[model samples]
Target chain A: MRTIAFAVALALAAGLPAAAFAQDEGPSTAEVDAVIEAAFPGLDEEWAARLAPDETMEQCNASANVPSDAVFEEIRARAAGTIVYPDDGVLVGSWENGEKLAQSGYGMRFSDYPPRRENGGNCYACHQLTPQEVSYGTLGPSLMGYGKLRDYSEEAVKAAYEKVYNPHMAFPCSMMPRFGTNGVLTIDQIKDIVALLMDPASPVNR
Target chain B: MQKLMTRKISTVALAGALAAGLALAAAAPPAGAQTDEETQRGLERFRQMLREDPWANPALLDADRGELLWTTAAGPKNATLEDCDLGLGPGVVDGAFAQLPRYFEDAGRVMDVETRILWCMQELQGVDVAAYVKRPHPSGGQPVKDVGAIATWVANRSEGEPFAPVLDDAAGRATVAMGEALFNRRSGPFDFSCATCHSASGQRIRLQELPHLSQPEEAQVAIAEWPAYRVSSTHVMTMQHRMYDCYWQMRMPQLEMGSEASVALIAYLVDKAAGGEIAAPGIKR
Candidate 1:
């Protein structure tokens, strides 16, 4: 019995039972929802609504972050439908302004309520574009020399713009956030981030 | 907003703390591959410092205050929490934490130590303590909530014992199942579940190492030391605060204190840590 218990412990530590137990004896969506509702009492309705998983999230959750090919395609399509491009045809903005946005990790938190200033992209939290900043996370790829690598083409700039706005459009179930679709970043903010990535003169390319 | 500590915590002192913390990393082996030579050596030196002098650490201040909080009569009921039971029978704190996250008959659910404390506060003191639920987490050397301090003291009781939560019955099974699903469920604007950063072993974000909570061995070591005093924030953070902080980072709404979902998640994580040694009031960075 002790050996069996040890084996179970070992399996859990190695993440071997992740798939099998993910499907077994799990609570239904409704049951989970009930628990969530009971979990947060003081949250305003606007904030509480975020706790509920939409169709996209529901599919993603059911599959354990790796949906089937059909579901993956559907998620991309559904997420794509939510994208709202900038009113003007311009895809890139000032890299200088974008640099500041990239460094900040403000907004979206409950503490930032009542609106103090413009929201930040918090880009540096996950990616390292500039060599000067030693403290940066490796959750996302380093886009250093981004424009230089792509030959600074117009099409590459457009792709960069879209990628910043909605990372899921390019890679489904990607660790990157849906900045544009979730309204975490404005069209202007995203355009500026694109400039940071696509402008050869920008630090990312330098 | 960043609280400007007038005296910027010196880089040299923080470096020393980091070296000490690295000692803890090597003392416990990871459940998966984590072959980093530099970290291992640093961890060895760090443990040496702890062995030299455990009393110099500051977390003991919180534990000191917590001991007083346990016996003192306060709240609306004008009563102390000393009579409260922690599943080792009424008023029996000895080895109670080691066997917690168990099914409580009165509550009809599985609850971890933090949730049990909240229950005792409400029942024995009539404190209406729910008013402070979901308040912003204290940081940057700010004062922590009472829950953090009390948890530190309670967890200190089983400092060396292995976890042994009771989970043989149906209610225990049901709560753990709910928590397991909750941990994996993707929701909110970010589409992030707890598994996004933690399910995988040997992964990290920036300098911080991420443990895979899905595995029992890893879960046992990681979760066993909550109500930890973080060097970066300089606050003793309880498990409830950790849940709140994670949800906030995902841009999800606040997790209500002592809520079923919170308790359920704790139940799942604590059960995963079974057989690991307890080392509460743990110092963190």
Candidate 2:
């Protein structure tokens, strides 16, 4: 599949007039879409709504996730609009729960259901939180010294909270989940996650 | 009329064709003769062993239960997981076990199937998973009794498929690259990343051979088998949970599940095993 795709891409890049390579068919959007759509045989209206592309998804799809500056700005602006900060403005919560949440990759799976269930941050899935947890991921930057490096300033702390709440607020097309904005987590949960990342006493800071 | 015309014009751009081309390339099989290769034979043998040698493979029982749990719905929503997105689409568990560790902008990081499912459970189904997220996967020398059953069920859906991540996009590339760098970046008392053991071409810890996840075959073998049932622990563990345990073994602070770094590492592994087959719900130590 890789070879064929590359060959087709090369053909298209070479300006094969679209007719030459047209004979050599590839996986079409419609085809992939059909396969994807068939996967969900019976979905409710709410569940089905998630199947289609949203605004951010459309932009990522159109640009192949390598959007230009203008598109980046647009995505960021749109994602930012989706962010809803806590009404109380307190972004800091207990670091202990945050620590547990960071370490855990549980919750939010098919097994965790019946809805109305409290969600977890599962931050450690893609990051090294503290010096103690050795089984961390290296997909994102090592935040071991997040607070120590930044002096744990009020702004940085708040920003960390919001970033976890909605990573798009910082990096427009971040791979991080919008914990707060998408309702994956609540204001208190966000605060706890921030504490896990930024509190000096927290293992992350140590 | 103008709006419709503009939409038509934009849709006709050559870029979409190019993007589609790239996506197709990203979806292709690996370079070598992966088609001719028979990696699944070993897995099949292992599976056969499970039935013949009960002592050798206790996970078989856990996996059987997992299969049942998968079809059963016990959550507050009282809805079975007939529909769940595993990157490819909803309920499309086939071939998805290996494609994860891909980028998901909604989460602002890369996510394996497990973490992504966790998000779906919370947002779509309204499951309060706060408590489980706090407790570790049950693994105290007994079979992981709780989640392992469900993990076995979900992982069993995509057995003997190819391992591929959708890292064709820049975000995907960046995520994998970040994961690579993190794998090499050492810190803490031991000053180790994932590379300390799994990076070297041929390294091992005690009895197990630690495959070099940076390379192809080894990466595929390691990443393809996850969300497995651990006989000794008697627990089912997702890759995310496995990673947490690994960190604990390293004596480092626990990593946050579904964090940017975790997703990035997943992307790195998936990218490394780009062409390998997907074989989940395997029996583990």
Q: Report, for every candidate in turn, its global Cα lDDT versus the true structure.
A: 0.77, 0.62
> Residue B147 in candidate 1 has what lDDT?
66
For each prediction in turn, the share of the native Cα contacts (below 8 Å between chains A and B) that it retains comes to 0.61, 0.00
* Model 1 lDDT at residue A129: 81
Q: Which candidate is the best by TM-score?
A: 1
Give TM per candidate: 0.82, 0.46
Model 1 local distance difference test score: 0.77
Interface RMSD of each: 3.4, 16.1
lDDT of 2 by residue, B103-219 (tens): 666666566666776666665566776655655366465555445455555665666767667887766765665566455543322223466567556443422456788888788
Tens-digit lDDT string for candidate 1 (B1-285): 021121123333554776776687568678344543345445556545643455434565676677778889988999999998889888888789888788888877778777888788889999776664545357666867676677777888788898888866777777888888889877776667888778877665645668899899899779877877775576788888899888878778778877889888888888889899988867665
Candidate 1, pairs of clashing residues: A12-B215, A12-B216, B22-B43, B23-B43, B220-B273
Query: Model 1: what is its DockQ?
Result: 0.32
Native A-B contacts reproduced, model 1: 0.61
